[model samples]
Target: MNISHLENQTFNPSTFLLTGFLGLEYAHRWISLPFCFIYMTVILGNCTILHVIRTDSSLHEPMYYFLAMLALTDLGLCLTTLPTVLGIFWFDAREIPFSACFTQLFFIHSLSLVESSVLLSMAFDRFVAICNPLRYGSILTTQRIVTMALAFAFRSFSLIVPLPLLLRRFHYCRTNVLSHSYCLHLEIMKLACSDIIVNHIYGLTVVAFTVGIDSLLIFLSYVFILKTVLSIASREERLKAFNTCVSHICAVLLFYVPMIGLSLIHRFGERAPHIVHILMSYVYLLAPPLMNPVVYSIKTKQIRQRILKKLCAVKLIQT
Candidate 1:
């Protein structure tokens, strides 16, 4: 198409393009390898965690229930972007239909919000376990766990439903080129020809109320946990109490640190190097799913032993 014809194109285009990385076109094949590895790790790791939890009757507790929920969320988050991202890197399939783009955007952000909420629930799990040992079972009963899981799903669905709908009402006259490898609300909204003040406002408001508040509550929960740990008279008891939370603490930091960094870079580092944004985005999306299972496996004795036993049984059968 001629330049003039392209410029005069209608606002309601059928497809949108995703530019994975600006200057890395030559290295798309190589880059996709690592991403493929990461995706495999994420899927296998979370699935293993879920499988182990399901098979172990001793793990039929509130903490493991929350953990199963977290694993499911991680699976959702990774799968939401995996298809389109790998397609761009491997097959040059960057043109996404308008409706599919909105659907991907919805799942990605909603799963992220769900993950943040799951982390907060895990923090509360730790807090109750550490702060009220005797009442832990009474507080986080099976019924309560089911209720919380349903609530989390409902809240995420409610908040994320309006985002794509809001964007659908906008007119897109500019080139519908997205910066990242996948569809996101802010990135997609940036292509709109019409005003997006409300979009921007609502996006920020959602992040603040959901992720922002979740982060604050997680930190506060840790603060109380530390206080409770310090009150114990014996040094070994204090250490033991803190040790139980070490895996969760690592998971929290792995998740939120990159997430917050990416948010800050997006808002303030307009002039930052492109690679910085790409790396931060990858870390934010990939780290938790890949690391959570490893962390829990190494730190939680029950899971570790069960995994070892299962491995041995498989090895024996093969031999």
Candidate 2:
């Protein structure tokens, strides 16, 4: 455990080992099968969503545009860790180059931030559509949507860039073995031989400013949305308006609840079991991408009908 002796050594590791599941080494191959299925589901589901939105002219509004952006970010987030995860579990390919590790860390966290921003944007869309239906179209124009997309991308990228760069400046003289299948900011930071106070402060600051603020604003938007929905004179109209938001609410909860749980475990669960960390990480990473498409398909009538019609057309062609 004493890594201080390594400080004087000239040899620096250029690669790090990723231990997929510490206690389940014997069943790594079997474990990989389920992960493979999850990866396929995420990719295919998100791709289908994007294609449906693109081909259907009726779905060209700002809401669908934001959903499409969410799908894109989900795809990015899933793919960022899939390869390394499967590699470790299936082939025992655990050696990751230093640069590659940082690159993966950057994408995984940056895309997560982008997804949070997209959720916030979606919340705004709902607030406007329900609160000011008359001016929803005028307020969320195509140009404005495009600008918001650019801003989301820029904010995530700019905020996450310094993380990897700062990490590079440190010499990781400690053990280069990672607990999970992928590189994470805090996990890697813990291996540094130098003082990491600045890294910790910056990481917390970024999360507070980005995901923290996004979650808060999303809550506020929904509060306003609920108030507006309640003002409807007819019970049926209130139900219909509230129903429109159900899918987004589920998506937000799916994404944030596990994320918050994982953060809590990392900070407070000092003596928690290893399996707890692995399971929580899986929930945080896997659930959102897999559930988002399913939730939307089941909740949105237009998307559901479009999907069924396409399926029937394919069945007819085969027949």
Off by over 4 Å in 2: 1-12
lDDT string, candidate 2, 57-141, tens digits: 9999999999999999999989999989999887888788999999999999999999999999999999999999999989999
Q: What is the lDDT of residue 17 in candidate 2?
A: 73
lDDT of 1 by residue, 176-264 (tens): 76667788787778789899999889989998998889999999999999999999999999999898899889988988898889888
* TM agreement with the true structure for every prediction: 0.94, 0.95
- Top model by TM-score, which number? 2
lDDT (Cα) of model 1: 0.86
